[model samples]
Target: MTVGLVVVSHSAQLAAGVVELASQMAHDVALVAAGGMDDGSVGTSLDRIMAALDEADSGDGVVVLADLGSAVMTAEAAIEFLDRPAAACLADAPLVEGSVAAAVEAQGGADQAAVLHAAETAWSPAGSASPPGPSGPKAGGGAPAPLTSVFTLVNPLGLHARPAAALASELGALDVEIDVNGVDAQSVMMLMTLGAGQGAELHVSASGPEAQQALDVVRRAVESGFGES
Candidate 1:
């Protein structure tokens, strides 16, 4: 089973809304909302959080995202109460963005560590280490250029949330380092920040063993308008 996600918020509606937003990009991922009190008050509840942790987890681990400090404490406590505490962990990240990023990564089959990284890194910064130089020399004793592609977004929404998640999730699984118009291609938040709209041009480049395959994935998503238009 894929990694699951739990959104802990003081308001029930807030948690549910975040789950709704994340689910759009991660249809297959288990997303649970643990918010408010069972009595319907606007407050954090350990029991609620514990129940959500159990429900969200399948076999793979679960990652928790909280809205506020106390919610985080509650989440931590809930995780500790689990049968196998290591099966769940809390993420220090923004509630909405982290949930979405984590959900998409999990949906893409990323392991717990990678999925947690995705959430923790969400909206924190837009940077990636430069890939190490080419592994080996070419027949002519020179390294090849990175695979590149250019696509005009035909989708009505351009690089919106769902499409950005699609790109980040699908591309993040590859061994390649990719850049789309100079932004980290594996970051959903960074891609959305591009403000690219319909008809905008995307210059994509990739390096590493899966460079060509990574380019193909982006090409298909962009050319097909992310299956939107």
Candidate 2:
């Protein structure tokens, strides 16, 4: 099962728009928008946040991303009111970046903790190293060899939001440690920070069970211009 996400913002449009953008790369993950008041004015509402939390949950836990201070407070209040507070968490991250990152991880079938970490770490610099490698070697100590490939982003717009999301979503599913030009391939924010133009080369490296598969997928997507004509 995949974790779900909630976007809490002061503006209805902002919250809904963020969900729409994130959903492009995470279609299967549940994303609920809780924004504005009952009358559609600009404000956070406890009832709305509570309802969104309930609707976003689907057996799997939920991670909440809020835009402003009051929105965060409202989310916390909603969680505190929950009989099972552990089922949800308020991620301290920028609304747009955090929502997109969280959505990508959730789409990859990550559990609640992983999803929360993904969102919380969206603010980290793109060039920074990943959280850390798995505790130890595999049972047989026969870890897969590192698979590497280099491809130039050919799309006219380069690796923009949509393309970044596409690449991140696909790579996120693989059991691999992938880096595109030194940035986490599974992080949309980090990928976007590349500012990779049309002719920029992407150095992809991974070492895990599906390392080669992940490399191939990225190669095909880049070569195909990510389906953009």
lDDT (tens digit, per residue) of candidate 1 on 2-62: 9999999999999999999999999999999999999999999999998889899998999
**Cα lDDT, all candidates:** 0.87, 0.88
The TM-scores of all predictions, comma-separated, are 0.90, 0.86
Indicate the worst ten consecutive residues by lDDT in candidate 1.
130-139
Per-residue CA lDDT of model 2 for 92-138, tens digit only, reads 99999899989988987889998898888887965353555533454
Among residues 3 or more apart in sequence or in different chains, the pairs in candidate 2 whose N, CA or C atoms overlap within 3 Å are none
RMSD of 1: 3.2
Shift in Å, residue 133, candidate 2: 5.4
Best by TM-score: 1
lDDT computed for candidate 2:
0.88
